[model samples]
Target: MKYEISGKKRFSAFSLYTLSFLSGVVMGLTVAPVGAWFLAWIALAPLWILIIKNEKLKIKNSGEKSSFLIALAWGIGYHGVALSWITGIHPMNWLGVPWWPSLAITLFCWAFVSLWGGIFVAVWATVMARVAQQQPWLRVLIGTAVWCGLESLWSAGPLWWSSLAYTQSPHNLVILHLGQISGPNTVTAAIAAINGLIAEAWINRQYRNKYLAIASGIFITCHLIGLLLYSRPIAQPPAAALKVGIIQGNIPNKIKLLPEGLRRALTGYTNGYLTLVDQGVNAVLTPEGALPFFQRDLMRTSLASAVQQKGVVVWIGAFGERGRSYTNSLFNVTGNGEITSRYDKAKLVPLGEYIPFENILGGIVQRLSPLDEHQVPGLPNQIFDTPFGRAIVGICYESAFPDVFRRQAANGGQFILSSSNDAHYSAAMPLQHHAQDIMRAIETDRWTARATNTGYSAFVNPHGKTLWISGYNTYETHAEIIYRRQTQTLYVRWGDWLTPILLGLSALGWGVNIFWQNDGNTELRS
Candidate 1:
């Protein structure tokens, strides 16, 4: 039966818009720095309630649908405030960008992305509301499947930054364990289900108690699953544990271009790596492009000396040249005095490392960027041969892409190393970036080491626990033990099959239901 409230109460257009926008604001607070993960479970309840109660079309757009405008208001509140960190980059003084122009570019980029994403969110809400008009009980399932599938679809959202699962990151590892069972989308689905239940309880007085019970059950089941994952031992008996060291020169991005700055960086890293070796560490990791020069120049410098010394392996980040094209890559060198293996970052940061759709939007991007971003992206699923065993390396921006690590782990990488230069942005980025890397560790069940310039460098276990970490904006170095694993989790072996399948079925079910509704209407008239 269709779910309807006791009364057909009409909410004002202003009230509905307020409800959606306010809910979105709550949703935005669930991520890092403001890690109030609890809000994620019910953040969308108000918006969902608004959709269920209001059938009248109020908001209008001449060139667009009503749903787009409705979602845009919500998205402006959510993504606008959530992405405000980008506006804090201070590119005016650093990149020679004019003050007002920098603010304008940042605002436009934020608005465009937010509004673009709002279109999809609006569509999802509209469909869910339609489903509720028929089988109200199915709305929760539909919401779960749609949202989970949406998050798994890498191309669905702009910049691949709209992961619903990433919102509960770093703090909500309990709920986060669902990612291991069925990718991050499962976590997203579970959160959506909670909001759906909340909306159900609010609108349908007859089913209020039933809705509340179902919501509690779902919450308990998710957390219990999380408990089971967390309670389990992360590591089995390892064949061997490799002692790895990380060195952060803590060189600020602005000064790295100067010759004197490069000299200081070279001296600092050289001292740090050699010092780690002296401290009996077998391997030392450096930050992304830590040396700030070409491979030939690095080979001719003090860095090569550490590589020449027997039994010590230096996994350093640098630029790889292939006939004028350069790549942000991790180069593996050992006491053998030559490069053994290298992994170029396959997933480059959009605009930061390489411009997206450059052939089409080249001139527009040029005006925004400070550096010559002519970098070529590397091939996917690369695993490097290290002294310990196979290893996966993510250079800088690739930490955001979990598939990079998962594929390598499946290919028998014992551990993951993600080297980044978070110095380009403010202090907040490092923390958020570190949280993203933690998800990769949990996803792959590999001991992960992240070395970064201007900090949040951490040693993460298979369970995504931060075993050891360093402060931001400081020159720091430390060594830790990393384990070698031999088993594959279901997610690593099969990828995100469940999410896509669920979403596809939901869309099919909705289409079929709509066909029946129209057919019945004609039959009744006849």
Candidate 2:
């Protein structure tokens, strides 16, 4: 079937797909390090318009298939641009892999990750096309709900970053504050609804004024509500504040595990710790893999001796033994030189930390990762009970998963400690990683002290403000006073309650659409 407006020329399938891809690229630009955040408000409008057009015109025999292709194009464009930092893994000659094979691995990784993210968008588009005949308001609700639901699903996967909500981080504080209510999904729903409204207005020119007015009202209302949430204080009186030190060793990824590099790291971290202790810091934190040695070997370091002599707590990131396997773990050593608590990283980076199919890949895994053996993941819902308070910890890629922090927060985490090693990638990856931490800070309403091996080490307040950040590839030690708040935000207490409700709404919309179609109710068709 073909349908056309009186004065408008219909777009070819190729043109529509290209437009969708470009629209997604625009949306990706809205995130860091580009930081063109305002573009996000309307960046998705073109893709939504394309989907609506394809659905209305019945461009192909299978509307769902065509819609999926269109949305998949958008997803590829978005992820490809946003996660371009993945290509930084190229030139792995330093890791003993040849130049050409290293390039192939890097490109493969980029395409694989982008395609994984694109699949989620394609699934949402396929289901959304089924309910295209519904009223504009109903369609908007169903679309936003389904989109948020899919995002929640993506979060459950092993690799997830580039959330729609992170687009507003560190730039648009008001919109980001909505995260406190129900995490990033709330912000994502708002963004999707607004784009849906605009698309409806564009497609239905006869009721353009009404649709635009409704969109405007919603835009203003979301911001106003966000302002209300942002203005309120998250911390209560009598909060215990701790002066903590963060160490950025700036160790290059190539030689981090080498003997000479080990000596340099030990001397650098030990001196940084003593310097911070001289400044009267209560505790010090190191980045992930900063020690890069076993727990037993870490105790012999000068840094451990300084901690015991200075009688100050030190949170050190090192390797731990779990029976026969090794684990990327963080240890909390008290002034008495005893390891009081340890949290192993639950989410390991694919290829970087462990091979996915060891039985199949075999020796190929060694060529890719620095580790000879796979690191075992820690159990879920682990939190460190320090002298100050219960601390929520995220190691490297684990910061991308919100629920990891949310669960710990719900279990009574007073503060957040994110330990990362961003030396493998360029500045773009760390900037985006830092944005995720900001969103976590707002959602959990906890002060965050992030330490990185290379750069972007900083302190974030409960409201998602970065109080201090270090330069990239720079060796530095900074101390800041961060309060430990027992107060939990609505998101923490209620969890991701919105995602499940949205998923239910999506299911009902699909079921109702199917029922009406079976009954031959043409009246419900738009």
Candidate 3:
């Protein structure tokens, strides 16, 4: 059955799919870099209307196929646009990958990841289509729950940086504050529920007024609560504040692995550290892989000697040896230049740090990865103990996962230190990555200091404000006063308590819907 676009106009299956895809593209534009955050509130309405209104065709197998395809199209557009930075892997001739092959590999990676993301949305649409006949309230609840549940599940898997919550980060600070209650999923659920209500109002003429009223109430209430949370004072007057320095070495990805690059990195970080020390900063941070050498090799360098002579604490990102394997790790060096603490990266980038199915793929996997050897992942729940206080730490890719930072805060981390190497990608990745840090700061109520190799080195307060940020591809050093507070937000105390509840509710709703439909069908047959 063709879907009606208006009173007389109609949309064919292809038109519906195209429209769904376009709607997703619009939603993608609402996220970071572009940051048209308001668009996110209504961006999914068109797609929802298309899927729910088209349920009349459910008697035919074509209906299921069409719904899945439409949602898949939408997902592809959303993830494709939001994750467009994946294309930066191209021109890998620097890694010895030829031109055409490099372009092919980059495009393939982009399409593969986009397709994976699209699959989650398609599954949600397919299930929701079965319940299109339910009450608007039920539909909205189930839709929001399923969406949040799937996002939580996706977060547990690999490659999940484009959550709906991030659309508000550093832009809609009021909305972002809701993350303190139940993490980013709370914000994601709110967005999904709002869009679901708007779509229901647009499609259900009988209940349009009711749905709109409820939607407005929810929208207003969320902002009000957010305002209260955002304004609530978490700062401690007696808490000690440390002057921290962030170093952005600005080394190009091409030469970063070469001998000359190593020398430059050493000099750059050493000079940045000495300068910051002169400014009276208590601690200094370098980006991930800023020193490509292992800890043993790094400590012998003049940089380590400088730290000892100056008697200032420094957090250095370098490789750590774990038996036969290497780890992407952050080391905490004391005033005496002794490595007192270390936090190894838990979330490793697939095919970048370590190859999956290495034995099966053999030499082919090496060609795809830039690393000389596979790196071992760190154990979970690692925190860095510094002179200032206990600190949450995240290496390059770990910023995308909220639980990593949450665990640290719950375990008594007073502040956050995220180190990254974003020199491989364009400005888009670093900016988005920075936005993720902002959300983490608000959620855990911890001041964050992020140091990156290329750019977007930043310091964010507990309120998701970027106090200081550096430009991309520039050598820069900045210091900010960050507090070490022991206060834990609800999110840190409870840790994503909403996800399991939402999943259970969605499951129960689905089961009840199925049982009710069966009972009605039995009565009709009798």
* C-alpha lDDT score of every prediction, in listed order: 0.76, 0.86, 0.88
Tell me, by TM-score, which candidate is best.
3
Q: What's the residue-level lDDT of 244 in candidate 1?
A: 88
Local accuracy of candidate 3 as per-residue lDDT tens digits, 268-339: 999999999999999999999889889889899878989999999999999998888899999999999899
TM-score of each: 0.91, 0.95, 0.96
Model 2: lDDT to the true structure: 0.86
Instruction: Give the lowest summed-lDDT range of ten residues in model 2.
Output: 1-10
Please rank every candidate by TM-score, starting with the best.
3, 2, 1
For candidate 1, give the lDDT. 0.76
Q: Residue 274 error for model 3, in Å? A: 0.6
Best by lDDT: 3
**TM-score result, candidate 3:** 0.96
Worst 10 residues of 3 by lDDT: 55-64
Better model by lDDT, 2 or 3? 3
Q: List the residue pairs that clash in candidate 3.
A: none
Using lDDT as the yardstick, the better of models 1 and 3 is 3
